[model samples]
Target: MITKVTYLIATILSVKAFPQNIQLLSQLPSDPIEQPDSWAWGRHPKEGFGYKARNSLTLEQCIDNPETAGTVHCDGYDYSYPVELCISMPRLAPLKVCADAKFPKDFCVSNAANMVKAKGCQKFLTDMCIMDISLATSQPCADAEFPKDFCVANAVKLIKANGCQSYLTDLCTADVSLAVSSDCAGVKFPASACTSNANFAILDNCKGVEFPASFCTTSVQIALLDNCKDAKLPKEFCVNGDLRMIKAKGCSKFLGDICSQSLELANSADCLPAQKSVSVFRCTRSRDICLSQLCELKVRDKGSCPQ
Candidate 1:
């Protein structure tokens, strides 16, 4: 009898000799032709559009060759694996950078302005004013550190060039008290302070936006619309640290499946009665049916769904 150690050594030798010939596959084994049950195996429909077969290798033929494996058998076997396997996908540009066009133009300007201020690149304020602010903000600035006084002066130059002198004057006037008093220590700047400084542009809930999660980030102008404050949603769907839950119910019409805006619909009368949730059908036969009937509903409706 071949000991386990002997079998392992043999396998290693075989692998080294025919490394390129071995092919692995994901399919389970079919029963022998002589078994009546072999003819009764269930069938599935042809793959639908966009369906991709899992990436796997086939090693049956390689192992069956006597020259490759003298006595071991590798075919006509079925095994269920506990762990899932997947092929590595090639790296691609991040969706946030590539999909910036899909978002509001203001977001680009806001993002660019943030980068400029974050890096303390006061000397480039004039260059930034003439260049594409949208693209500039997507990448880090080359030189981000500079003297605070220089940055302050350069910021004034930017505000003037960007047609924001009056706005800055008003803001600085209003903020003078905070700057001088103890409140200055606790005052938190807005996320888009640079853009707001330049043109009074600010994105509401800017921190909450994420690609494929929320359709797009919204502004305070949209959130403050009628009944926006009274909207409510289940606690589970709310993003932590978001102060926008009160407007969720009212803003549900504008959000996507994975965003904070969708949380607003958690309290909809239609969903309240249905005990079935998207989470319940995750890993069973019911999952396919549930996805086909319900989860797709949300996707088809662009987020105002699962009702």
Candidate 2:
């Protein structure tokens, strides 16, 4: 038998243990992202709360164009516009729950609405991105060629299994949009998808990255790189040869020219690796040639620097 003191300590320890069970419906964002017990991307309004107030809008308009659909009037701030459905949701990060035993069908479905409230549709997109990569590599994500609807149905199972949700809304929305617009099946994400947590940035340039909707805002470095051409590289990258080569020659001029443009690369980290990618792509030893060819393509195509 355990003593009261020992039992109490054990109970306390369990709360902070790795993969601790979470109540899917009621979990809140309080832990830091780096902590083992912290739910990844579980921070509330990870982008920041700037809206004055929420206004009612049709689901269609919101889905069709969230930015222009309606305005959110706040107390102190000017009337701000509504964001995407994914971003507008109060909480979108998935609750980290324990999967010790097989869950009943009702527990899965019944809690789905609540789970949606907690996790949003972000995870779905991430899974789709992973699936696209798997397919591109000739490694099917699953054993069978299930229909799109079948895949959609299995999405619930994915959530139940604690799978990713970064692109959930995009996946389902794409399916819905297929009948009306382009085929969603053809969408392909770059290798470094969802690397940043800038919500506005993701919506603008990093859509393929599939960050939580809350991460739609720009970062300080990204914002700074916009107006400052003389912006220096973080001290660490300056010392490294390959990385420095990318910055000094390959993307140096390109970075100065386009990194400031909102539509082009703003993240300096992204720029460095992108510039370095020319190193492996070209068959030439001449750094200038490699930089001109690869960097030009990246700038012209609006594509990610090679991974």
Candidate 3:
């Protein structure tokens, strides 16, 4: 009877121990399951967000998978597509968001004011404002902005009050004039403001302002004569070589003689190549013989030229 009881107890202990041993074996750590390197979460254009298994699955398949569902989040939501996914996947190439977005009128003006305070109005207009502000537009502008016309109106007011010398300086003179005549039409600016800068004196809007005689230096005179001699009026205004002309004329006449007869020249078929060469005179100064030949041909009748 004692042997039988001892054997039975031993059997019971062995059964329990067997299960305990199995549990211990189960608890031991094993190699981790490797995740696919190509898999990542991305935003879906229409369905919000999902995982993107770039190597193994298409965008549609990833979105369709039950494991990839999520909410969208992004700063420039109105101006961006596949919105939240752009922010979520920082490792991916950046998307061009708000590329064509324009700042709200009040907000743009306010931001312009802040920029002016930081860097002065000259830097704001010349350096910052001239760049494409549309790309800089974000959710704030979309949410709080007004119409573009309103923005232009207020911007003009800001310029008038703070002084727009830098805005009206150099090539900016023509750009500002065009803006005034078209989109900013009927927006009156002080004549004094236009005439203040010698650069603006040549523009039609700033007519009656005397051409500063001191502006035409020896280099400017040479460039003007070289590039514009024998060229016709109205058709091929020396607009193409305006930068070179401006550089030759110095800062006093920074706004080259774009509208004048002396500076106006032919950019017509005969002179196009020569005009191009003249435009880059600083680079092609040694090609004087080529330029003279082209210029001579420009004035001669078609029949007089050699084949």
Candidate 4:
């Protein structure tokens, strides 16, 4: 009986031990073998499944046949997609219809100015349609509106063809002074070139160009001399020292002793020498008396006097 009971207990323990061994085996790490079409192969589409052949057709042909065209490349090979498809793809490049297409002569001629301005000189010069239009209209480049960069590159040609006035006017509008441009070297402008344009006159290149005496007023001289440091002004104009003295207090007293009626007389060749001689007198005595005494000394020493 004891052997029979012990065998029954031992058989029960063997059955429990078999279940625990199975549970421990289930808990251990495992690597499943991958199947050919299983999810382990990745979610990407297989080659040739979603592929589409690139349509080889001109933009004009594609535009004419939209449904048959499918996705047509507009901007060469850089951007190969339809215009409508560009909305979905924000990275798509801009269309270059004018660059790649041929338009009617009348259309390009009529819109030449606008097109050239929009495209700029660099692009306008390269575009066949725009270049043809430029040759037809002869604007912007021919007129005072020529681009500064373009003018700088072709300064000699433009100046020789249009003269310095027109070239300077264009350069002035662009805020490029001839003073800083080596291309303007040895170019002699006309005397009246900068009369109407004060901005042009103040350019360093204008210093050598003569001006009308009437234009060189005291106020204008102040501005002109400030810019044209080495300008060879007419002798009649007062020097910087004289101009300062004229502006100082009691300047009228000196003017009365000198030539009060006319500025030209005050700076004249004869008056300059007389003024220098009288300068040592300090204006304590009458200017007329001092002048007379000097005149007598000159007459006695030289045995003759100036008429």
lDDT of each: 0.32, 0.33, 0.34, 0.39
Candidate of highest TM-score: 4
- Candidate 2 lDDT over residue span 128-185, tens digit each: 3233433312322332233344345544333212232444433433333321233333
Candidate 3 residue-wise lDDT, 46-110, digit = tens: 44333432344334544444233332322212233243442244221122342222333333334
Scored by Cα lDDT, where does model 3 land? 0.34
Give the clash count for each candidate: 9, 22, 1, 0
> What is the TM-score (0 to 1) of candidate 2?
0.16
Stretches of candidate 2 off by over 4 Å are: 1-153, 156-193, 196-232, 247-307
lDDT of 4 by residue, 1-307 (tens): 9997895576556445543321121222253222212212111222211212233455566555434322443323232344344323222212332233333334334445444432222233323232442342354433323444555455444543332344654543333454346655544445565555565566665666655445544343433443333333443343334544333222222432344223454444434444534343322333333334333332333322222
Worst 10 residues of 1 by lDDT: 84-93
Stretch of 10 with least lDDT, candidate 3: 252-261
Q: Give the Å error, residue 257, model 2.
A: 20
Give the per-residue lDDT digits (tens) of candidate 1, residues 109-176: 34444433422234354344334433222334333332333334444233222233324433332433
Better of 1 and 4 by TM-score: 4
Per-model TM against the reference:
0.18, 0.16, 0.19, 0.34
RMSD in order of candidates: 33.5, 30.8, 22.6, 17.0
Give the top-scoring candidate (lDDT): 4
